[model samples]
Target: PLTVLQGYLEMMQEQVLEGATREKALHTMREQTQRMEGLVKQLLTLSRIEAAPALAMNDRIDVPMMLRVVEREAQTLSQEKQTLIFTVDEQLKVLGNEEQLRSAISNLVYNAVNHTSPGTEIRVSWQRTPQGALFSVEDNGPGIAP
Candidate 1:
C-alpha cells in the first residue's frame, strides 16, 4: 500500500495528472491510504491480542452479517479481478471478540486476494457443525512454498 501511495505521489509530483486521470489517481491514493490505516489498526489489535492471551469472547457475533461486510470489502479491495463466492449459513452465530474475529476474517480474505492471480476464484463460508461453527476461506491460488 505504501508502495502504491509512493508511486502515485511520484506521478503527481512529476507530471500534472489531468481531469479523469487525476481523479482516478486521487481515488486510488485514498483507497491505498485507507488500506494502510486498516493495516496499522490490525497490527495494534494483534499486538494487544498477543500481550493478553485471553481476549474477551463474550459477545455473540452475527457471523453471516460479518461475512457479508467482509465480502463487500474484499470486492472493493480486489476491484472485481477475482470471483468472490460467499456461502454463509444465516443462522450461524459465534461467541468471540468481535473485533478480533472480524480482523482475522478480513486478513484471510485479503490474503487470498493478494496471493491469487486476477482470475482466481475465492470462496468464503461459514457453517454450523455438530460440535461448533466452522469458518473457512478457500481459493484456487498457488500453495505455499515449503
Candidate 2:
C-alpha cells in the first residue's frame, strides 16, 4: 500500500495524471492511511489486552448458548462465502469472563470462516473433557501445514 501511495504521489507530481486521476489517487491514499491507522490501533489494543492481568470475571459461562450466538454473529462475517454451525453434546457450564471467552471463540470462528473458500462450512463445537471443557473451530481452510 505504501508503494502504491508513493507511485500515485510521483504520478501526481509529474502531472502524468490529473483531475479524476488525482482524485482517485488521493482517495486511495486516504483509504490506505485509514487502514494503517486501524491496524496500528488494533495492535495497540492487543498489546494492552495481553499485558492485563488474568481474567477475574468468575461468572457462569453457558457454553452452548454462547456458541450459538457466536455462530449467528459469525454468519454475517462470511455472509454468502461461508456457513457457520454450532454443536454441543449438551448444556455445559464453566466459570470465566463471559465476554472474554466469547470474544476469543468468535475470533476463532472469524479466523476459520474468513480463511476458507466460498461455500466452506465452519463448525464451532464444545464438549466436556477430563480436564474440564474443550472448544474447537473447524474449517476446511488451508492450515499452517498446507
Candidate 3:
C-alpha cells in the first residue's frame, strides 16, 4: 500500500505537475488517495480488534439485516460499475459485535469492488447451517489461478 501511494505521488508530481494529462492525473490521484484511506481505516479497525481482547461480543446481530446495510453502503462506494447481490436466509442470526461484523462485511465488499474490474458482479450471501450460519463473498473477477 505504501508502495502504491508513493508511486501515485510520483506520478502526480512528474505527470500532473508537468502539465501532461493534468485532469486525468489529478483524478487518478484522488481515487488512489481515497482507496488508500479506506485501506488505512480497515487496518486500524483490525489493529483495534486484535489489541483489545475484550470486545463486547454479546450483541445478537441479525445477519440478513446486516447484509442489507452492507449492500446499501457498498452500492454507494461501488462507483456504479459493479452489481451487488444478496442471498440471505431470513432467519440467520449470530451473537457478535455488530460494528465488527459490519466492518468485516464492508471490508469484503470494498475489496471486491476495488479488486474487480468494471461491470463485475459481487454477491454477499448468508445462509443457515446445521451448526450455525455461513456467510460468503463471491465476485466475478478474474479469480486467482491455481
Candidate 4:
C-alpha cells in the first residue's frame, strides 16, 4: 500500500510538471499519502504489540472507560457513516495494561470496519466470563466463510 501510494505521488508530481490542475493533483496526492501513512502506522503498532510480552497486571483499570475510548476512536473513524454501538456491564473493573487492551479492541474494530459495508452496524460489547473479560466486535456484515 505504501509503495502504491508512493507511485501515485510520483505520477501526480509528473502530472503537475506537465501543467495538470494543481488543486486536483494535490488533493489526490494528500489523500493517498494519508491513507498510506495510516496503514503503515497501524501495521507498526500491531507488530510491536505482537513482539512484546503480555503486560503484567500491576494496577486496576476501569474496564468500561477503556472500552469507551476504543469505541470513541472507532466512531471517529466511521465519521457517522456507520454506527458503533458499545455495551458494557456496569462497574466493570480489571487488572491489566489498559493501553494494550485498548489496542487489541481497536484492532478488532478496525477489522470489523474493513469487512463491513457502509451504513452497517458494528457492535462492541464486553462482559465478564467465567475466567476473564470478554470483548467482542459484532457486525451485521458478511461473516467469514468456514
Instruction: Pick out the ten consecutive residues of candidate 4 with the lowest summed lDDT.
Output: 16-25
Off by over 4 Å in 3: 1-20, 142-146
Model 3: per-residue lDDT, tens digit, 6-125? 777787667536455666556777777887887788789889989987878889998788788777888888878898888989887889888888888777777787788888788888
Residues 88-128 of candidate 4: C-alpha lDDT, one tens digit per residue? 98687888787876777777787787668898888888888
Position 56, candidate 2: lDDT:
89
Kindly provide the TM-score of model 4 when superposed on the true structure, using C-alpha atoms: 0.71
Question: Per-residue alpha-carbon lDDT of model 2 for 1-146, expressed as tens digits?
Answer: 67777888888788776788778888999988876775686587678779989878789888788877777778777776887777786678889888778767776777687679998788778988899898988888876353
* Model 1: lDDT of residue 65: 92
Please report, as a residue range, the 10-residue window in candidate 3 with the lowest summed lDDT.
Answer: 15-24
TM-scores across all candidates?
0.68, 0.71, 0.78, 0.71
Question: What is the overall TM-score of model 2 with all chains considered together?
Answer: 0.71
| Residue pairs in clash, model 2 | none
Q: By the lDDT metric, which is better: model 1 or model 4?
A: 1
Name the runs in model 1 displaced over 4 angstroms: 1-44, 143-146
Q: Give per-residue lDDT, candidate 4, residue 51.
A: 97
In terms of lDDT, the best-performing candidate is 1
